[model samples]
Target: MSKILIIEDDLSIGEMMTMYLYEEGYEVKRAENGTQGEQIFQTFIPDVVVLDIMLPDIDGMKLCSIFRTGSTVPILMVSAKSEVTDRVRGLQTGADDYLCKPFSMREFAARIQALLRRSQSFPTPVHETPAGHPIRLDFEKRCLYVNNKVVETTFSEFEIMRLFWQNEGRVYSREELLNKVRGFDTYVTERAIDVHIANLRKKIEADPKDPKHIKTVWGVGYKFLPDPSLS
Candidate 1:
């Protein structure tokens, strides 16, 4: 079973989220403050974290940066600040996804489910690539490394990178990638796939704007070019 940690200062909101998550059969841990939340995070080592931006200590953004420095576990940030800058700042701080306050429990649950599904979805191993960049994908550990340094990625980004690594030269359309990576009935749009690819490129490519690994096919789709010299 997947474990979830909720770090919310408000007791009522924390309890409500706990109740709903419990109903979904997830192992839930609640922390009312940042100090306690950080402690629980070390011990519980949850699969996902539901973080509130307004915390008693160590605000969500700081906590997110701390977490990002060590692990790749998915983080869903929740706050009353719904402005574009708030969302962008949360993402920049390393939160995988952000949800404004008063969010529907249904959408919250769906986001959690999708994140968990993507994190657990890994394909069989493929042949090795010729030496080039110092990028490495460890299928056994489900980790990515750039120049031997750990690289953090969201669940969807990881899935997309794994697919591209496995296929190497095969081109994948947005619809095809959605079906292959997220599966059907997931409610993810083609544009979401583009977003995932974009995020993955930022982490994997030497230059995201001029991606060497994930190349856009313009009118067709996207393909992974393993050989840096070829393309």
Candidate 2:
């Protein structure tokens, strides 16, 4: 089973998310604040994290930065702040995706599902983003889809996606992914993957501000989180 940790100061919101996640069949854990959240992150090592930016202690962006230095666990950032810079800052700080306040529970579920699907590549060949509907990967054509339409993608990102689609739910540390995507012959650094992911998000996601798929696993690496229910 996939583990998910919720780090939010709002008890009501945290509990609500926990309930939804449990219903969705994820192993869910909760923390009231940043410190407690970090503790859970250390002890539980969840596959995905739902983090609120406006915590009472230790702001979410800074915490995200700290987490990014080490692990690559998928992080979904929730915040009341809807500013463009705020979202971009969160991404720059290493958050995989950001959600603004007052969101629909149904879309929330879909977003989480998309993030999970993006994290783990599997037989389910297509994925979704907030801006566009679904991104279908064509292994034979080396092409991607936005709904039914095709989108241009770089070769490097395509290679990464192929690897991710094959690995699915398994965690691929930076070194591991580099070796796999770049190949031993290419001698590519993990940072290369980072650059590629950033660019890929720009191309595939309709609203990069709130990405529906492709998330960051702070401190460790990135993942293609697929919806666990589909598994």
Candidate 3:
């Protein structure tokens, strides 16, 4: 059974979700605050985490960043704040998916299911760039290496990098990139894609101000250039 950890201070909501998830045949654990959430996270080692944004202790964004530092576990961030900036910030902070409050139980369950599917579907083994290339991708490890040094990347960043690296020079609109990385069902603004792309450039480009690997297509979207010098 897939293990699911829910860190939510709202008792009623947390219990409701736990009951539904249990019926769905998942092993579920709930934490009421970020401190407890952190403790449970280490012991439980959940496959997917459903985290609430507002906690009495540490906030969800900080917890998400903490979880992301050491694990690739998919995070589904829930927040009552539905502003575009809030959603974009959550994605930028390393959440794989986000849902606003007062959401339906069915959609919540579906979102969890999608996360589980995506997490399980990653290809195994390492993938390397062509010889003389500066980038290397380890799919099995879900890590990126530049110039033989490991570069810290969030889950979303790694996925975007993997897509761009595999399909060099192909322009992907923000909408297309969002769908490809976060799944079509995930309701996020296309601007979030721009945020992710910008973050990736910071990690991979020699100079983020003048990016060489990931380039903006202007009037469209962005594309990757394996060998920017040749382009």
Candidate 4:
């Protein structure tokens, strides 16, 4: 059974979600505050997290970043704020998905399902770049190695790299990249993709200022060049 950790301050809502998720055959745990949530997260090691933005102690955004530092466990941020900026910030902070307040339990369940599916389907055999290439991708391990050095990457960054690597030389618009990375159900602005790409280049490119692997196609979008010499 998939484990789900719900970090919600609202007791009624938290209990409601827990009950529904249990009915869905998931092992569920709830934390009333961010501090407790963090503790449970370390021990429970849930498959997915349901986090509310308005926590009594640590806020959801900060908690999300903290979780990103060590694990790529999918996080679904729930917030009463429906502003575009809030949603973008949540995604940029490493959340896999976001749900605004006043949401249906059914929709909530569906969002969780999508995140779980995406996480579970990510692993495969290691993929090595052409001989002498500086980059290596271990899909099963979800680790990126550049010049034989392991590079730390956020979940979004890794997903973007995975897609670009699989379809090298294919240009993808910011919107297309957003949909491909975060799923069609998410509605974040395209600009978030730019931020993720920029962060990714910093880790993989010799110089993020003039990226060699991910190149901008003026008037269109961005494409990955497996062979940096071609850039």
Best by TM-score: 3
Give stretches of model 3 more than 4 Å off. Answer: none
Candidate 2 lDDT tens digits, 86-196: 876665566656678787766666656655665565354444444533666776555677677776554345667777766676667778866664333221245546666
RMSD of each: 3.2, 16.0, 1.5, 2.0
**lDDT of model 2 at residue 197?**
76
TM-score pick, better of 1 and 4: 4
Clashes of each: 0, 27, 0, 0
Count: clashes, candidate 3: 0
Candidate 2 weakest lDDT stretch, 10 residues: 181-190
**Candidate 1 local lDDT, 1-231, one digit each (tens):** 999999999989899999999999999999999999999999999999999999987889999888887787888889999887787677667676778889889988987887777777655564344566667787766678777777877655667778888778888989888777655443324655666777778887889999887899987789988676776
Please list the residue runs of candidate 1 whose C-alpha ends up more than 4 Å from where it truly belongs after superposition: 124-127, 169-202, 217-222
Model with the higher lDDT, candidate 1 or 2? 1
Question: How many clashes (backbone atoms < 3 Å, residues ≥3 apart in a chain or on different chains) does model 2 have?
Answer: 27
List ranges where model 4 is wrong by over 4 Å: none
Per-residue lDDT for 49 in model 2?
82
Order of quality (lDDT): 3, 4, 1, 2
